[model samples]
Target: MVEKWLVALQVILAAIGVYQFTLSLFGIYRKKKHKEYEPKKTFAVLVAAHNEEAVIDALMENLKTVDYPKDMYDVFVICDNCTDNTADIVREHGWTACERHNPHQRGKGFAIEWMLKKLWEMPRQFDAVVMLDADNLVSPDFLREMNNDLCSGARVIQGYIDTKNPHDSWITAAYGVTYWYCNRLWQLSRTNLKMANFLGGTGMCFENQLLKDMGWGATSLVEDLEFTVRCVKNGVNPVFNYKARVYDEKPLTFKASARQRLRWMQGHFTVARRYFFPLLWQSLKERNLAKFDTALYTITVYTVLVTFLLTGYMWVDAALFNGPNFPTLYEYLPTWLAVVSVVATCAAFILALILEGVKSWRVYASLITFPIFLLSWWPITFYAFFTQNNKVWSHTEHTRVVRLDEVHGKQVS
Candidate 1:
């Protein structure tokens, strides 16, 4: 009976994995044919930077390249308690810069709220606000496309953010491939199907009114995800715009990646606990089927972690107790098939990297080591379970002076 149960569970898990894979492939297909939209109104580009002086120059240069009327659109950088020259760099570009020295409210959420309140107080304002990280570079037409989405009645628009340092190391390469696959396939398919998409940290646009009402009260680790969920529950479906591209630097070291991902995992777990019950109950009461889907996706983070643990336990049980005499169902299947599935997943990742036009052969070779990268997250996920030290806002250091020519052999300008 135990063997039968294990077999059933394994089969179900495998089927779900395959289904998600297929959905991702369909998303990639849809993304290829996505149309570009032009902006019909002015936008305010808000950047929250803390000690980002090294990269602020490139970011400012890219900001100037945005295809919009300079007099109409303005750039606002909120230097959140920075002891560095981040504020000075923004001011040097003749752009609007606000320096906040609040030691108590230190998170990005607080910085954004402070900026929004400041914008609201101004006599002249923008129709929409575009949020970006200090290390991010917007494409020349980013504002045009995002503005079009705003005119089309989309209160929230998410743009594609690709990594700029894929060739820095094996760790960065793996992250590049993962991000490329997700943006090109997973997000595209879900958006086409009218499903919800969580807001990425940057490359997102919001209506001025919405931000005014919400006040960025979600001062958590994954504030972007938390805020996105709040907007979805409030009847705002974020629209994904593949045409509006933003390039960001990836974490070049394992230590940096682990810290960043752990914070994300912890934040996700926190959100799951806080909103799952309330959202689930509200969805059922209102008979909102889409809300149900959002709730399921939000809850799946913890479920996937649990499933990984349970699967490992079953494998160990089969290996130790049911080896020869019991002949467990999983043991009957050819080991080569499991190996082949993993290889196929890697092949898909390689294909995605190639499709994104990555040129480094060494980076491509690092694709074989991708499994190691995936396994590195296990420790972080496990640690997140027992960790209640959510007070300290762990910030990832971004070194921006390194140009794309130095990393990838091509300069944007």
Candidate 2:
């Protein structure tokens, strides 16, 4: 009986690993065949910066180079309680700057809310509001592509955010590869399949009315995830635009990376607790079974991580403790097959990394150091699981000047 149960568990885990791997492969294929569309609308680009004096100037320069109508697109920077020259830098760029002094209501969510409220009261307006992080440098045609998607009736659109400084260190390189893989395979492919895609913190465009109706309530540390969930609950599916690219920096140090990821994990946990049940209820009430399944998967990160670990343990135990006298816990053949399935799943991850390297020359150098980048995540993941008290926002350190030419093969501007 115990042997039968072990076999069943191993088989189930193997199947899941195979399924995830297959999805990733299919995702990469779909990304290659993605098409681009242009929108006939304008955009209001809103940036929320907190002590980003170093990077704000470059961001403004990149914003100015965007391939959209100058009359149709305008930049708005909300310097959220910055004790730096961020506001002055924005003013120097001849852009609109809103200085917000909110000590209690910290985090990007609050910064976004304050900006949205201020924008809502303005007489002059845009068709859609594009939200970007202060550190991001968007591609020239970003606005054009997002506007195109919006014109095609997409209420929300998420753009591809690539890393700008992957060569900074091994940790950054690993993060860069992961980001590329997620965006190119997971997000773009899922979007093509008509599946829900979460809004990344930056490079997302929203219909003005949707923003107004949603009230821009920023509460979670991972505001983007919460916002995406909220939109889905209200019957809005975010569209993914592969042509819209925004390059941003990754944490250079392991400590910074861990801090950033902990915040994300914590925010995800918070969202799972607060919105999961309500969203599930809303899905059932609206008869949207598909949406419900997506929501469940979004909140199942912890489960997925736990299952992966359990699968590894079972494989090792089966290999070491197999004998006729002892009598194995699971069917030996299925257990071996399960081990093979796990290996195949790892192959899929490597394939995704190689494909990303092929897509961009800048990432190729970092790919050699990918293993080091991955191993560093284990400690961070372990810490996140135990440190349930990580609610306070830990800001990532971003230096003002970037080695753009060395990393991207050309100056950003």
Candidate 3:
């Protein structure tokens, strides 16, 4: 019975690993053709800020350099429960500043829903709405690429999330490497395979019609992910636009990054509970492969915990029931296979850096220790399982204030 159970568990882990590896391979060879569409869609760029006085000014100034037409997009900053001068800075840039003092509803989801209602109340109706963080610098061609996606019939689009402070610290470098890998492997692969792309909190855009139809009702800890699941269930999968880039400031310290990820893992648990079954049911009822894919993707965060527990149990079982005929747990997985897996994964990370045009030698060196960062997720996952019900929003503080020119040393067109 123990041997049989071990085989089943190994098969499950192998399947997950193989599925992800296949996707990464798909991402590597896929080349998407870019088409320029006439800028016809009016946009309401919404920036959610909570006392982001340090970075809001830089973001506001960066928006001024966006290559899109002045009349095409309007910027609005939502200063939620901010005692700082976040609102004042937005007004200084001649952008509309919306101040909300609701301590009860403090997360980005509530702020977004509130802002959507505010936008509807006004006379100006937008064709689409772009969501962004206060601690971000938009690429010059951000809106233009989004416009191309919208015009090309993508209802919900996610932009490539780049790190603004990749070299500031090892934590940020890990984040930079991770985001670059995901952009190519996860997001781009899903797009190439015609599957749904999950939305990062920032750098997402939704059509006004879809927003009105679905409404910004996601108030979970990771509203972006919850909303993505909702969109998938509704038969409206979000697509990835690689050209639409948004540079986000990463958490400088490991502790800050861990806390932020803890909240995210907690939110993942919440969303999985709420939508996993529904997504599965939808896929079965409609025979939709996309919905099924989304369902599978939803539970992937728990993969680390599941694999850990199963392997640990197998090891203990092997120790207790050792015999000459019974092979140890380590014997089940060939050493060469494990070595190849690690090498292939490291090669992929290096490929991501080259493709993303990251030149810093230090950033490349950080990849050697990136596995430590990935391993850190184990404890976070365990803790999140116990505290998943605690939905308190813990915001990561952003202090690196860099201009658009400073990000890439040249404007992104």
Pick by lDDT: which candidate is best? Answer: 3
lDDT of 2: 0.75
Those runs of model 1 whose alpha carbons end farther than 4 Å from true positions after fitting are 1-16, 31-39, 281-289, 314-344, 354-359, 402-413
Indicate which candidate wins on TM-score.
Answer: 3
**Global lDDT of each model?**
0.77, 0.75, 0.87
In model 1, which residue pairs have backbone atoms overlapping below 3 Å?
A: 39-144, 39-148
Clashing pairs in 3: none
Q: For residues 122-171, could you state the per-residue lDDT of candidate 1 as single tens digits?
A: 99878889999988887787888887778778888899877777777788
Q: Give me the overall lDDT of model 3.
A: 0.87
* Residues 1-413, model 2: lDDT tens digits: 86566556556655555555555565766544434555468778999888998788888888887777788888999998889999889989889999999788788888898888889889987789999988888888898888777767899999987878766677776777788778766786677577678788999999998888887775688889888888888788888888788888888887787788878877777777778888888788887854675567556545545555555565666688652322333445666866776577556556666665544554556666776666555555556666646666677768836533444652121
lDDT of 3 by residue, 21-100 (tens): 87877777557577788888999999999999999999999899899899989999999999999999999999999999
lDDT score at residue 226, model 1, on the 0-100 scale: 83
Span of 10 residues, lowest total lDDT, candidate 2: 323-332
Evaluated at residue 261, the lDDT of candidate 1 is: 88
Model 2 Cα shift for residue 350 (angstroms): 3.3
lDDT for residue 134 in candidate 1, whole number 0-100: 89
